[model samples]
Target: MKTKIILVIIIVLCTFFIGMMLFIKYYSPKEKSNQLLSNVSVVDGKQIISITAKGGYFPRITNAKADIPTTIKLNTKATFDCSSAIVIPGINYRSYLPPSGETIIDIPSQKAGSSMNGTCSMGMYGFVINFN
Candidate 1:
């Protein structure tokens, strides 16, 4: 019957839409907002860069001062993923952060054109800080 065919078509479309929604919600690669200055701040003559670590590292790219002393503060809350194990190979720094707290890391003065990069232990998430 025409009614039966229409019902079947509607049910198929609904099922397909739900499946697509679930795929995007769980499997998509979520990146941080591409803000140039949203995550950088200067305090007491030191540049402090704050980034969030949860499903992924946010504000993935940051810009900061090079000549002044610098530190990166990572904020984590209920982060049980691979991102909890942060590694900064350039500084020979690696640590397992607390599930919900702030982890501060000190960095030596960087040259104006230098950049610092960090990654999760599994390398699935990362962030970059460019000095200028």
Candidate 2:
């Protein structure tokens, strides 16, 4: 009788452990990583450009009419492209006033499980362009 009781207890314990493991493996919440990119255009005489970007990323525009500043929030490694062109940091990233024409800029996020926030200057006829 004692042997049978021990065996039953062992089985029950094993079953409980296995169920718990499975639950944790399949039902536990998971962390999600996402990337977002957007395109924005600031025309001459405009002070701000408000547009919704994908992947929960939003670009804040400051001084849109003069020395425009753009702020972007990123959750993961992403790439922002405009007019099929890629813009590099600290290099011609600024747009001229009366904004000669539309300038495309690309922002790329290349890391996992990371978020990035940055501010840059923009000008009229400047576009956030595209991202991935």
Candidate 2 lands at a TM-score of 0.30
Predicted structure 2: lDDT: 0.35
TM-score of 1: 0.71
Candidate number of the best lDDT: 1
Each prediction's total of clashing residue pairs, residues at least 3 apart in sequence or on different chains, is 0, 14
Regions of candidate 2 where Cα sits further than 4 Å from its true position: 29-71, 74-132
Q: List runs of model 1 lying over 4 Å from the truth.
A: 1-36
Tens-place lDDT per residue, model 2, 4-84, is 999999999999999999887766533211121222343452222333322222443222222343333222223242211
Per-residue lDDT tens digits for candidate 1, residues 5-58, read: 999999999999999998877666332233434688788888889989887787
Estimate candidate 1's RMSD in Å: 8.3
Clashes of 2: 14
Q: How accurate is candidate 1 locally (lDDT)?
A: 0.87
